[model samples]
Target: LRATHPPPRPSFCWAIHRDLFHYCALNLAYMAPSAREVDMALRLGFGWSLGPFEQWQLSGWSEVAAWIEEDRRAGKTLVDLPLPDWAMDPQRQVVHTPQGSWSAARATLSPRLSPPWLKRQHFPLRLLGEGGSTAASAGRTVAESEAARLWTLDEDILILTLRTKMNILGEVALEALDQALTETEGHYRALVLWSPDPHFSAGGDLKGFIETYTRHGLTGLALAQERFQRVVQRLRCSAVPTVAALQGYALGGGCEVSLHCTRRVAYTETNLGMVEVNVGIFPGAGGLTEVARRAGLRALAAQSPLQVADYLQEDLTRILRCTVSQSAQEARSWGWLESGDVLVPHREELLHVALTQALALAESGYAPALPRLFPVGGVEGRAQMLAGLVNALQGGQISAHDFEIGRILATVACGGELPAGTLVNVDYLLGLERTHFGPLLATQKSRERIQSFLETGKAVRN
Candidate 1:
């Protein structure tokens, strides 16, 4: 490969397993700059790494340090691909963020995304573009952000932390999701997607949203919504059976993101809700569509500020719809957690669990998916209840889901074949919210208060 830019560092060579090149040739997720973000459902919900590398090239090839010495002696182009594509970033920290594909399917349905229907692909792809030691993660977070790495789960059990302190995975998170899936090949036993920190995810960067809004108005908001919708859809469609581990709070886009996971295992005290409604805007990403299709169990119960009490009292498991654990350490012992699932309280065991599970799942059998539906995505009673969200979104209306509705919608969204290495981006269907609901969110009561607190760190209301 020739350099249009300066030669990178030799240290990056280790990061670029020669095996990746051979693997990238066959791995579709590595095919293009955009493919950095493939699908994210069960297959690669967490992240992707070295999924398609040729093991042999990487075997017995310990270079970097030696390579740097060699470059000093031979004057050859040292290092590897340039990471920071200033064309897409502001900080321009020379770093490469790799990726993998994401997808899933339920029983009887094939989960592996069928290889690219290239004829339908809008952009032409080159295999060389797929695998390279050099890759870029458009902004998202700082270059050294360790929390943002893509991961795979093939073992019957693994632990994750969506409630991350690092607030990992922004635009880069999506790419990581794809990359993780490409390497893992949508095969695993059980994946417990939990966060080590108490916060699931704060959601997309408001500054990023503001930039988009400043530039495109409603169009910008719609664009962001489209991107997130693609992400949630991909996560929802992951193939390996998965579960989301919740301990504290999974708010805003984070909450919406969690809705995309197959199962949400939470502590009774964990607070979950779509506070977006409080803010004047509806769920911008896929929240509106997702919420309107459900029975409103999580939304209704989470907003109460009484879920923990209820779970502790043992009055709401069926009603609240949560896997309330008495303590974080009890996540697995109590059955609310996967065998290897972990909470910060169990960090030591959790780390071991994470590694062990990652390796185990690296070679599990994968099936297609069957997305759930509701008033959320499981839209069921529409036959008798009302036209429903699918009906509304498919048309141009606003619809919300209670638990019953969410169940129905979840059902409908399920039951389809997932395109391997690619998540379905439903940006086309999300433009409506920008014009009708975006304005309200901008000026809404609850959202305004929350934004004010989030921005200035003060709470006016009691």
Candidate 2:
């Protein structure tokens, strides 16, 4: 998967977009299914990023059709299929819209395809932000910053959508999230964190960090990261009901934000993980803290107090694995998604389901989750975790750098200098994370890892 290699086409692009355009045109030549279903089938069934019609348009339907017609004349037809009417009449309109978060005109089709739980009563899609100029036809916009927007679906539901490239959790987006949460209080009953980008988020904008760190070094990077963490903490404690509508990649900070939300309505196809380790860092933006905390809670709930340490270790190991989930169910197993959270099979209905969940919580009188003193197996636990990690490194299961990261992860999980069976708060854990994380930013190995990722899009094993 290098730039030098031939670029891979979207899945099924060759078979469906090119071959089927000529070979199976007869099936679609006379009668056409709703473009939504066709698009859904391509996306859900084959994992194609774009459907046949969209890909055809990109290649110019008229030109492709003429080529197909020429190929057919050359006896190159796979089947004697008549040319599609839409291909012949390129001006004919198709009920198609780009699959995006703000394409609410096409959102109406979602309800029909959604689950029974998504109560789509009168959810009028209204875009909120300074992008009123373009989104005016779709929905009303509220003037927020350009990178993020507040979308109102109904009187009670407010959707805070990140509009930045890849919906990266940059300064603007985080600030907008804080502002939206603050402004929507008493006015909007609930909030849904969403994005129009294919990825819910790719985590913090690495390009942003690369620039800052390259220019001003670790001091500037630390300040930027601290501000990001503050917003994440705020989201975790926001009084209003909040739901993360997640699909595609929710890595590192993206996954951390979802973990902090009141609920997560995730698409089955979500690729969620705390993937900061790939860049020689751990999940410093509340991910490590929350994963350990939530796993402890689950273990505590099961009346298996002895299993808390084991659960925490499992979570820590998963973070070190940096294993991106293949599906939402896998994400749940990874502790990135909770058991009570909703999983949507269709990506199209993810937002609707999330908004419904948010509204449900709001109607039931939503309250911020109480702060928890996570029961940790302090020094004893850290020793045991370190022993295991050391053994893994000796056994060549992980690299020396991975072992170092794991040691930091274990120390943070153990609540710093606390004794065995001690309970620690979020602030204590965050302090440990920040303290451990800061020095890594200045490490030659860390700098090399980050640079390798920025340049090659892969981790340096050393």
Candidate 3:
């Protein structure tokens, strides 16, 4: 059906040839993401630069072509990464600003070839061509610099030495992660987790957010969330011995990123927080779920944790789990220093550590597990947790209504059976979370203060 472009101008975009069209099919919804399931479905969907790729991506390509071309003709750009999966590695990312990854489709351009026009505009691509691995990876010379370096150990582990300044949430970072995952096998035994600088990451590109939102409304939010969530999910579940070497400032999504790793070895200078609530949004990108599992309930999550302020203040403030050291030397003293752990003191050492870790993981092994079935904490247990929140809402101990609404929405999202990843899609079950969480969230005001107390950090000013 994709090839017959004859007769009337029943035109199509690039007209994906028979070979490319063969890969077209419905992506199976894996009940469990394992074996063929993880790499299941059409990853080609992600790779093909949206265009008049008539042969491959019939409808999706068509839509993309129209959208991108419209933006370009208006001299406007979305400033979003084309390959969002690469942004997971913050230290080794490059931004090609003022250029869209996919070319304007109307001009009948193929994304495979870098446009001289875009290069003339100083398109910030690495400018590698479509060719052999060695030819594609030819080096670029530069003076001494402060960018974090990455290394690999015969496709086993991948180490990331993040220092300061450069950001990694753009498409370049996403591409790197995607490529690594595509190439590798599994985890490493000696995982190194230490950074040269105190900070891990600064989260997604904020300026990009500012630029895109001004032009696109909810569309910008949707796109950003999709890309952000991709990194969040990958980091949370990559099949390897993951370690975060934290020296400082893993805030917002960065904090969540740290939790996804198996080990979070931090210097005392590491101050982690999911402060998205202060900005009128929750850490909707699996931050809460990851933190809950990693650090227990003390680690605050977005929106959901507003209910447990007292618990966070008293229990989580101190005695948080894992290893925390005032300095790298002391970290070794702690049990955090496993039998063969490597210590990285400077920029070079850290990059070597990252290289070794990432490459080791690539060749580690692969037996991807089935997606975990989220427990309801038993029937009595489920009732108890639900009752406590209900009582808090009724007795005015808590002011927000989102808790109950989310419970109801989440329940509806699963039709009573719980799924791990469903809660993030709160809007799907409009039967509950979407319709109710906001009003419930806004239940308290000056006069309409449904419930208020020093403990309740209510959003209502009136």
Candidate 4:
């Protein structure tokens, strides 16, 4: 029978999807205990970003309901379950304004409630009610660009959200960040660098880098790097307290941005790293500098020079290898997360925790970290670090390009050719990042690596 009368071309597929969606809606109306529960269960159990109903809401509740109704009328539904009146109603939505989430079993909208165990979790923007639909919404947004927006959160705290693809740091994002900082100075008590997306940020926009290099060559790339470094520097030196509410992938520039914050509140699953070496560039946006600074602090705490050397060796290896933290705990152990930083077990609690930390800092008389000099191994340290890289290069461990990147990273980490045990300020280390970054961006092999990563979304050994 099926072979004799085949289903129409695209309609067959459409019918299958329509029936599946209707079945889900029926489950919501009849079998599911609560809409939010089903949503949360699917999200937590399957790693879905949105629950079935939530996704349907985003796809257009009325439109999808209309499609299902048409299917039911045509007797095309696989289960033949009668469409619920609430599901068919054009005026009703799964997530309605003011009244909150719809209760299919109760046939009414009610304020959404989380379970006791999950009470701390929340959607940051949704606190603004209907106006919190998108970053472009006018109610909470203080500053916005195509790439990012600064929105007011609870307790006069501002959240700078990146809206770019994968939340990559680019020209527009940098501009929005600068604007956010300017607005946050005297008005807002604290600022949180965050995003609602699953990944915090992938890194610098490699596509943008390739485009810039293609059109204006290395000089354009240099200018872009300078802008990024300067913006991140401003975040480091901002007048008000800053918190980085991090989750998912916070790689390269994203990691650098979090590193500069006054405090970080990271989710348990957060993957943090300075992974610019994968694309053939070291962390030019002050990532390596921050690592070096942390290493220096650790060395300073050591009782003897031998211990200092050991500490420096362990930390410097992180830089050369472009180590990425697999979890919040690893991030802390790797020093990407500081002692005072927080780790949240739940993803939804990230922003809340960060905001709480920011508020605490503001209440306690938060001050930007004062610039200070830290000891670097300088020329001697650079040579000491390079010795291992040289051996790796001599063996089959790393490519020539990897060795070059490692050499530059070591030089910057050691504060250039200055003598051992020399104390240098943050600005000096930052300058080294900017200076060395250009030479690397100018290299053909580096460009190839960047292009490869941009095209394939994966790093090349070359």
Candidate 5:
């Protein structure tokens, strides 16, 4: 009888894993370079998050070596090179020490010379260790939660690290931030918000929002939004200097958090934006308010009202389209990054630069910025912005929901029914955000867009 069923297919991951093992084995036998060097080459040259040797070590070196041996015996491996003795020995680690990593060629720990690696060694106390210790011993750790931690540096600087997945801003993170700010009042000279994750923060917890809305309805979502806004407001009004060390994607609430900080030190690769509109909501956490504030300041500097009008129009375009800056330079052009903000060329140098700037600010007797009235376009500005959206809607250039979002954004950005060139405080702009946010969130199309994004990670125009 002929077999009708097709044979089981090999996994792509397994094939890649096997190839990686073979490649590392060949390199170790012939090139005789340190595992760290190989890892660094792949990271710097190829932009891999993890090198072959690093991935192997992460997957358990001995276990992977044994599997390779089995494959070699079965004539399945790409190469016949024997696994290194050091790798098979469970006691010997490839990169175990802070000072250096193990080299197969030298059969010794090679000294690590990377600037970031060297800098990290200076700070011996992390609030939470690799083993997940949360003990607040010897003033090293002031506060900690599952989502975030507040730890001290060498010069009375508090480092608040968001530990959530993608460092998403949630209730736990917000609470931790509030506690960190409270602790920083008289104790720490400066505060730095940073993370070791690939992303500084992807944004607010979309999954959390879905769960909340599904189980507890709009009221629950509104309460959560309110809590987030209050915490961010406190960050803006913080007595001490707050520095944001930004890299990777700083979108939505993450961008808002950085926006409120005293100064931002960004990596050249950093991507920043107020992208909540893609998920069918506006930046309710003072993001639009900050943009409006910046636009007002720029307009004040301009010699003509035409320049002021252009600035407002540009910001309006960004808000409605959810423009995300591709690089630090672009972010600066978009006005998300300020002129005074420092841009670090190396990812490793971001925290160092940020810390230095924070210390400098503190030493220079930095004071929190006082709340002041800023110029807004007011009712005429809102109408002017809406006119373009109305055209786009009539011309079928944008969906009805897009027009609706633009309208709400226009209202918030223009300061909600005030006269042209009205001067309003930050709190008033913030209030407008909260007020308009609910209506957009309440819409069925907006909810659909949010749900689609959460499920597939793709924005739905509807």
Candidate 6:
């Protein structure tokens, strides 16, 4: 007769979500004897995004469950909530499901089911002309020196995995990727960029950036940016359909890399962000440009002809704040992802879905994005953004350096002094980004922040 949980206010959803999760978790822990039943009950009853067991897996079952165990022992319990059986056993903390088993403690996903397409041939590639073999089994070699590798799936799709340290984009890795793309051209039906490494990528190597800037100064940094730009742009406009199988931390340049793909198949647990602001620089490698482009497209889609400045304010706020999407769904909300981008329920299904999507696009005759002009936010947007920055600075909410960064971002986003009616293309935004970014690399605050990050693995805000 009556609805169980009333529709919540906008501000109340977070509290409701948190409270309901805790309630369900506690009830399921003690009452329901079976893990699958508990999972099913919570998912079906409340229409939860993830069941309690899955949420437990994501939140570190062993540690959080251990806390529950200690709390139970101390009699600091809530209602009649029972402790989960698996919580009592350290070994059983890693929950098992038909799709896969994930151990939050180990950060490992061991899939019980493998996709049908993966049953085909597996090939190992040795890039950079280094062909030394050591226990080459099933075409996968254990090469210590190689930075990139390609695997042929179903003899049609070529999956390139960047194998550098932390999967960071080094010069060697970039060079190998470019060569792979060039060689695989017209040969493979589709190319999928993927890695089973803990992170899709942490981003470009900051250590490499520091080394280059220290040694070659601005000239070296400019050259490196050019190479990075060229490779990413090439990927963006590739003839063969491309898909990035993304998971874990895809931040900064890693985020940029995905922006260049024909399509992105993101794992639900992806932690995606454009975090260059943390390093005291704007996104130089087509990331900010991509964001601007997406914002422009959003404005074009609106019915009421919303001011481009309104969209710019919202989008640039995310960039300036280094907003990270904790899940695929959230990434979509942030406009980092397109409506057409695929969201894989299980991380194990990411590559398979990507491969399938790539094949479908290829079969449908994939068309690369056309070179088109976008409407820049222009003079009005720039004035509004600068005024906002000034207000924030006056309020002592941001540092002077941050204000300068915001100004640079505003200039780039609005196409740098372009008139209100002028249409700006991708090249214009990219050029503005590169021009501003190079100067930041030469700044003391940026250098200090980069150095601090390198030395202490923490951002130094000046």
Q: Could you say which candidate leads in lDDT?
A: 4
What would the per-residue lDDT of candidate 2 be over residues 1-462, giving only the tens digit for each residue? 122345455423443455765643455423334444555566667977776655665566677777677766766667655575544666633324333221223322232233554444223222121121232223445545778877675667877878787788877888898888887775778888876556899888766776777887777877877887788988878888888999889988898998898899988889998888778888888888887687667767887644567778877877888888899998887667878899988665676688778878988987897897767657778898999998999999998888988888888877777776666788888877878886776677877888888899886878
Q: Judged by lDDT against the true structure, how good is candidate 6? A: 0.73
> lDDT tens digits, residues 1-462, model 4?
224555685577666667767887787767665566666677788877777777677767888788778778788788767777777787765554455656788876656654775555555324212333443453376767778888885639988888899899888888888888888897889988878888999888877777887888768877888888888988888889889989999988888898988899999999988788888888888887877777777777773322333556766676568788889999898777889999998777787788889999999998888887778778888888788998999997999999988888888888898887777888898888878887787788988888777778877788
Q: Write the per-residue lDDT of candidate 1 for residues 183-221, one digit (tens) a residue.
A: 333443545454545455655555555556567876676
* Candidate 6 structure quality by residue, lDDT tens digits, 1-462: 013555555325434433444465555435554444455565557765666666666656667666555555666544435554435457754465444444333334434333565443132221111233322222332122488777664778877888777789888888877876775575777888888675888888788887888899888888899888889888888888889889999998899999889899998889888888888887888988888787777677783223677887877877788888989899988877788899987665676688889899899988787887667788778899999889999999888888888999988988888865367788878778778887887799988888899889998989
- Which residue pairs collide in model 5, if any? none
**Superposition error at 300 for model 3 (Å):** 20
Better of 4 and 5 by TM-score: 5
- Evaluation by lDDT, superior candidate among 3 and 5: 5
lDDT-based ranking: 4, 5, 6, 2, 1, 3
Candidate 1 regions exceeding 4 Å error are 1-147, 151-169, 181-183, 186-192, 265-269, 296-368, 371-437, 444-451, 459-462
Clashes of each: 114, 2, 41, 0, 0, 1
Clashing pairs in 4: none
Could you give candidate 3's per-residue lDDT for residues 1-462 as a string of tens digits? Answer: 225767334323322232122222111112212112112222223543321123223344334344444443554443322312222123312211123122222212223334554332211212212122221122221111244334443434444443335333444554444444333324333333334443676544444444454567445545655665565566545665566666555655566566555555554444555553332333444554443232212223332332332222221211111113455455344322333444444322343445445445545653334444222112232343456557666886544533443243223322244332222232232222223223332333321332231236343323
Worst 10 residues of 4 by lDDT: 124-133
lDDT tens string, model 5, 120-212? Answer: 333322211112222233237777788887887574799898888889998888899898888887788989997766688889877777777
User: TM-score of predicted model 1?
Assistant: 0.41
> Considering summed lDDT, which 10 consecutive residues are worst modelled in model 2?
124-133
Worst 10 residues of 5 by lDDT: 126-135
Q: Residue 24 of model 1: what lDDT? A: 35
TM per candidate comes to 0.41, 0.81, 0.40, 0.80, 0.83, 0.71
Error of 5 at 261 (Å): 0.8
TM-score of 3: 0.40
**Candidate 6 residue pairs in backbone clash:** 30-82
